[model samples]
Target: LVTVNLTANTDLNSAEEFEQLVIRESGGAVVRLKDVADVVLGAEDYDSEVRFSGQKAVFMGIWVLPNANALDVLSGVRTELEEINRDLPAGLEGGIGYDSTVYIRDSIDEVLKTLAETLLIVVAVIFLFMGSLRAVVVPIAAIPLSIIGAFFLMQMAGFTVNLLTLLAIVLCVGIVVDDAIVMVENIERHLSEGMKPFDAAIKGARELVGPVISMTITLAVVYAPIGFQGGLTGALFREFAFTLAGAVLVSGIVALTVSPVMCAKMLKPGMEDHGFARLVNRGFSRLRDIYGRALDAVLAARPAAYFVWAVIALLCIPMFRMSPSELAPSEDQGIIFGIVDAPANATVEETARYAEAANDIFFSEPETDFSFQLTQPSSGFSGMRLKPWSERERTPNEILPGLAAKLDRIAGISVRAVTPPSLPGGGNFPVEFIIASTAEPEQILEIARTLQQKAAASGMFAFPPIIDTKIDQPEAEFLIDRDMVASLGLNLRQVGEDISAMVGGNYVNRFNIGGRSYKVIPQIQRAGRLNPDQLESIYVTGPDGRLMPLGAVATMKQSAQPRSLNRFQQLNAVKLSGVAIRPL
Candidate 1:
């Protein structure tokens, strides 16, 4: 085949040109292309359709830039979506279908609050034990320097301030303060021995250098194995482990470099025993005496201490057996999606109606910020975002049961309300069951439906389990009579070509008019090909060069067939998935 490029011109700019273009001269009369074929404007045919919640809809995904801040990106998207909703035509709506950052922001805020409270507690404990404001100041100074130094290293390593990294920083708050505490306590001991402030600071730091280095290295080593974990576990925790190790290492450096200097400048030659300091000292001294007496008693009753230890060890078996285990905890992000599936042969318009009805249930709730629906032929999906936690009394979890009940009341469609997965890339449901077999599709579907019913009846899941199997779609089958074709002087190949060209249309040729090439497809008019009955009236060129009716040579029948087939491990399979009602 040879290919050629041609520039489009004004004469053939529109569909009307197909009707005007000359096909050939027949019997010395001009025969336009329309004389033998139909030319009309219609939408391009689509082969693939998207369905969510068993409803027809289009899929859209939003991506954040590599260097962009997630919180900032989320804020911008929310603002823009709000603006878009305002400008949308009446009855149109928009909403976020799935947002990963919602949980990220919430987790970070809670972690930060915990870090602040922890810092306050640590400072108070230091002051109470040391009984000197100067001694307390030394450890407090180390906190900010170490944390800020971790941030600097994070920036250098191109790490973003995400949930895992922030968690690492929170843990470092406790671990990093240990080095400073050891240094200040040693220096205070020297001060109590009547040494000068400068001499005590130098000697105290020198004496603890070995121990400080050992402690820092030991903590870092404990986290090092986490960084080396294999597969997905490694990918998720490596950043967290390394960030914590870096913070501890930096804290040790700060203690060695700046801690002694601060102590020398801030401390007085002798400890002051007045006001809060004297009271705190007395309280700590009494605690030490009580601890000392308790320790001596334990040492003297060695057999009783061993018996108590054995009892504690025996109790651990029940505790271990009773505790729950899970891969990841569930998260509520104030959003949920309802998947809607109609019968396989349903139209997009029908799916849209079902989706809109489901959306009405969500919109009726006071907690809903907004609701949106999407529909494709045979299936549809709806999503809604709830008001923030501060504004709403109930969470998505609380709202879900009511919403599911309401959705169940809707007729002609199956609906499932699913929460977003806890971990990124995890499946939508907490558990998925795959039934693989070499059996026929009908048998596989029967098994799947039975499993779904049993699962729903068990009351162990949030809703009825979804059976992932295709429905039978309506199809037309043409049974050609070879005897009738031969009697009518009709060739089967010619009849097929003519029918295909007239009904389904054919790209017979291409033309150019405006620097772009356009295909020329000619088919029977919509009025002539609107229904299966019209197939009888279609004309086919027989071998005798005479026009023959298609109905005379063939018959059409309607039946149902699977719309799609899915396989797993080279075997036909049906899948079932649902969220567990109780934590597993």
Candidate 2:
């Protein structure tokens, strides 16, 4: 608030101004804020805290705008972070914790490289067979245009450029150009029979239109079931199936229309058989003669061929048994989460110290870009992001073994570096089991430890199996005497309240200071509450208004107990989890 007068004016808009304002006045004296209470600048109390790399820090998340390009958003965010880093103080830094664009870019780039290599192979094979450069160009030109045309259909179907769709396009590089190749081959056949280029193209396309449509429909029907599938399979492959079907349909159209027209315009009456083409033609001719001889021999000795095929089929049984199978292949996502656990009785600060030691080791690695640490009372987690795939030689999977080794050496903490599962509704590990028991927690713990040890000794797991149970937290039990309390004129409630106030702080009331209200809580000083022996000094009031020592009414003993209890289907359960050395 601001105060104004005709001759004088004062601005009192800041908290300091309000704090310094006088609240009471007397003769030759005044009661300002300093007279009644202490006023010092400090940070406001927070309900939650965040720690990174074992140091207290703030965490922030950036979300891409709806419908915005992911690469563009990532670029903008990276640029802003660079600028922010420049302005930060020395020894302070900022870095990306997670970036989806890395995986998306890598997947697309690999698929594109595969697509290009496939195109080259297809072109080379076509040239080797036809021995004509002009005929090869027809299929090469049809491939791109047909694939691009599918994007229009994809747009209409509300699909975006993603891994599945790009994969479909890559696959279409071969399938989409099939019809065009057939058309060109037939046109070449007609040309060899002395027909004109235009007439040959028209006759070739007319004869193959029915067959091309039939082939396209057959391929489309194969993928139609994929699009209609339910559950996870359908959700994953719907885009892939539709994209391939659309590309095949477009190619069929191009074969009937653009292919014939282009062939008529570009293809010549005959190909020159000389130089490289002549050499390739000679090689192909020799190969064809050998194939013809082998086919005739196979037909004459069908029993021998059948016997060889039968032996090969029998061998396939053992081959299949030896092959590894998995629901999803593991992908290196350029990040790994290290879950660190301290003893159950450890404080948050102690856990943070352990996390810091682990983080130091992580940062020392040349491949690590940055790391974020989260510490709780007895557990902590470190999320370490590696350098980009293009920048680093080793992937997260390749580096996990070394990192886990270093983290395992950190004292007072157990750390496990885990790559998140590719699929949802599962733990990070490949194998997980639950041990349910109706017995006591001690028996359950013993059984779980025995099973974990057996599993570890089997040498079938990448890491020792971990049991999800904790029973190391420190506790104290107080045995109270009701008769002694009643005789001392002190009730149980009074004793309870006194103990609570001493340990947990007693909330008195609320009061205002500088226009802000605050709760007032007072408790016993640190030295008075440090040991169980000190409990004897804590006094409770009796009905006679006399103080009675708490030790006279209760006996205290130390013990250890489980931090938490877990149940499965109304029965206590211990969860065991580990990664398998081989897929199961």
Candidate 3:
């Protein structure tokens, strides 16, 4: 088969050029594609729309790889955004409207601020408790050393500096301080007891060495199980547990190795003879007397202690059983998502109006900083980014119920406000129960409805379960008569293609605008195809190039059918989704 190429140009960059596409040529009467169809460029799906703060908008999201750092990835994206925004055309703007990393950054900043304030408070408290600058210095040295060592341990464990790990660091401040302060007070006590600085230091260090080791081991043992346990709990808290355990171990080491040495060098005879030291000493002695008396009284009634301990132990099981349990406690991520359920047959415009109502409900809360909405023909979603955590006292979870109440008042649309998943991988809804079987879709749907009703009756869900595999969408089927089509000398393929061209919204070819290739989809005007009656006006090619109305070859059948055919693992599936009133 030999072929000769006449024109090298295959890229039709405009509708005018595509309209000149050759269809047929006979007796010098060439028929172009424009004669049979209209070529226009438009959005891929007219049913999907997005808005930011009530304006048409497009969004782009940047995600970090699992092994990569989120902060670093967002840092790079933010830098790139600056350049992109600088080059945007007039009357247009581009920037990050939403960033999950902002909450993380703010959380980290808040933790650091608290850490600084705590350190200052720790210094003052230690001075007042000991009435000795020497004691304060020893702890100041030991605390940082322990924390830095904990950071080293984190590095060895390949743990990132995250919320949980930082929280461990903060908690270590108290644990490490206890070990350091105990060692300091022991050496200081020796100094006041008339022991020489060097001898007191050695004796104090040796005396408490066993106690320090025991304390460190006890602390480490408490967190060790948490680090090694199975499941999401272990994964989330492994770094936290290990970091805290490491910090305690490091604090123990520092207390024995550094605190004693510093105490020997810094402490001197008559150090506690000062007036302030005597006053503080007197107050502690009286407090110690009161504690000693209380202890003696408790010991005098020995059976009471045993009875109290027995009662406490017996209460543990019931208390634990009755406690509210959730995957994780709700957190303030500064955003709330409003899920919008539109009628199955609602148009995109109708969905948009529903979404606007949802957005209004979201913004009705004074804490809302900004709002966004997205809509499709059958569903919609909206979100409100609350003010910064510092500005808003209530977390997103706290505000969700109120917003949901307001949203419930909107007629027709069902809007459910939800906080971001407390834990990762929870998906959009709390309850995503799926019913799958090899049975027919109708059977699966019936089973699903039964389950959904049961779930609603249990009073566990915030709303009635919404089944996904609903057979309620109205459809108009074009029932073609193959016999009539054949007798009319009409090609079945041409007939189907002609009908598809008129209303299918399928792309035929690509046209370029600037350097971008756009799809050329030829569909009847929206006004002309608004109902089933409009389908009759569409024409198809017949014998001898005659144009025949589609109504002559096909009949319209109105029926209710499933909006979609859903399968899971090759089994018919129906998903019932809802929010749980109680935590799962």
Candidate 4:
């Protein structure tokens, strides 16, 4: 037997000491660890990797704080990026990998376009129906005035103009015009009854005050429930609901206060003698006569009318019960979100390979503008930003099923393709159920597997549900032989320490350089420890300080272990999450 003496404790402070470590001394010409492997200092693991626009790039996610404006935050990020781009080192650069705010800005532009179109349409419709520029002008003036008042109320309530509030403003155009139109028509009627324009305006406003108040109350109440709703609905719609209600209330007040004066100034005696007015008045007269006769017939059949009204009222319940419900409707946000789930034993590099396969599928689509990815050891999230809505013939919703099918075909991985949520704080998957128990996590994992298998058999999901927690990580255990170790004149402690030092990747201590501390770790290079079979070649110091193969006294046994264990509510819990094939 050969003996190698340990004289003093050695502290490896740099790569050179680790490289010069002695694995064994076979002859007068010594053998060293460097003969079989290389030593290097680097990160413990490359767990976080990002790919942007199909190129290797870094990714950073920015989340908005509560009560903060997302657009403003995005703007600041963009400005900072410009400065960062300027200072970037040669041939290296940084910028936004993907911005969710792109969709928000695009949607805002579409809503603004719709707002302008609605304004033009409103003006055209009023001109066609009333057949008087003067009548159209009066109501058109009220539209802007009421909107101004609504803006004031919104400011007072600490509301900002957003997508939903902009939509409320678009809708308010019609409601504000409604009050003005009513005032104009009623005044014209009084004028035709042989009153002066000034007298008719005053009389019409006084007579319709009650009707206008009731109209305002009814329209305002329609959106009151949405604003008062308890959770997500209320939070999302409070601005929309109150904006609309406040606009209508302002329109009513404006009509009672300002529209009557404008009507008097713009009206004249027998304005119906002008364009389309005479024909419209004639048509209305005939329709009114017919309506009078129909009313008399309905009064004669009061019993049947009562029965018909009651039947219609009862039909609402069944219609409502049969309707499908969901938290929010699907929208084409111009991007597709994807989730990559690899085997529990998979490494970062393995998962990245799977992610690449999925990314190719995403990038292959005709509408794809760019693709981005964030990778982890066993799971990741990725996405593709599509071209503009006007540019793409198919929306993200239309393309999702086929894309998902293609992603599922990738070997050795599960890829889920979905559209991003239209609203904040919404679930990414359509189906999610939590299973909690006081039993051990292993027990809960078994129960979760059964549920997932049953769910897959039922064909409810686009694919089988994925459990959040898994007990499937691979492990390597050395089955040390106590008798053999004793026969070799070695104890288990020496063998264990030798194995741990060589492959455990534990840091021995720290060394300082350039005012910063770096961990000093000594381990067999990655190439030497690539697989469990290589562990047999590792040498440990025996009781007499002679080097011997670890295989002589210990054997490695392969097994599986839990990837993670989590506790929820003081109980082990597992979540089953999936995107359903059909809306549930």
What lDDT is obtained when candidate 2 is compared to the true structure?
0.80
- 242: Cα error in model 3, Å: 1.4
Kindly list the per-residue Cα lDDT of model 1 for residues 1-584, writing each as its tens digit: 99999876645666677788887777899998777766655445433344343344455778888668878988998999999989989965666666768777887898889889989998888787778888788888888898898898888887778888888988888788789888987887788899988999999999999999999999989997898998878878888988898899999998988999998899875565676877877888899999999999999999999999999999999999898866677677888888877888766667666766787788888988766566667776667878788999987878889988998898968778877766754566778888999998789999899888988899989987777776678877678899988887667888888888887766877766578777777667667865677888787886568777878788999887887788989999888888887765
Model 2 TM-score, 2 decimals: 0.79
lDDT of each: 0.80, 0.80, 0.85, 0.85
C-alpha positional error of residue 83 in candidate 2 after TM-score superposition, expressed in Å: 9.1
> With candidate 2 superimposed using the best TM-score fit, by how many Å does residue 277's alpha carbon deviate from the native?
4.6
Q: Summing lDDT over every window of 10 consecutive residues in candidate 2, give the lowest-scoring window.
A: 40-49
lDDT digits (tens) for residues 1-584 of candidate 4 = 99998687565667777678887665677777677766666776567678987688877788899889988999999999889989998998877756778888888998999989989999999888888888889999988998999999999999998899999999999888888889999999999899988899999999999999999999999987799998888999999999999999999999898989988888998899866888877877899999999999999999999999999999999998988776677788888888888887777888888788888898789999889999898788898889988888999878988898899889967878877667765454667788889888888888999999999998867778978897778888999999998887878888888999898878877865456688766787667788888999888887688788888888889988877777778788888888665556
lDDT of 2 by residue, 54-82 (tens): 46787787778767888888999999999
Candidate 4: which stretches are off by over 4 Å? 1-41, 457-459, 478-501, 508-518, 536-557
The CA root-mean-square deviation of candidate 4, after full C-alpha superposition on the true structure, stands at 6.2
Which portions of model 1 show Cα errors greater than 4 Å? 1-11, 15-42, 45-60, 63-121, 498-549
Please, what are the lDDT tens digits per residue for candidate 3 over residues 1-584? 99987877778878788789998999999899889777666578788888887788997657789889889999999898889889999988766667888988988998988888888888889889888776679988988999999999999989999989999988888779888889888888888898998999999999999999999999999987899987888889999999999999999999999999998898778877786877888899999999999999999999999999999999999999998887776678888887777777889998888788777777778999888777888888777988987787887767877777788898967887777766785455666888888899999888888998898899888778888887878899999999998998877899989998888989897767899877777788788898888898788888898888898999999999998889889888889888776765
Looking at model 4, report the run of 10 residues with the lowest lDDT sum.
420-429
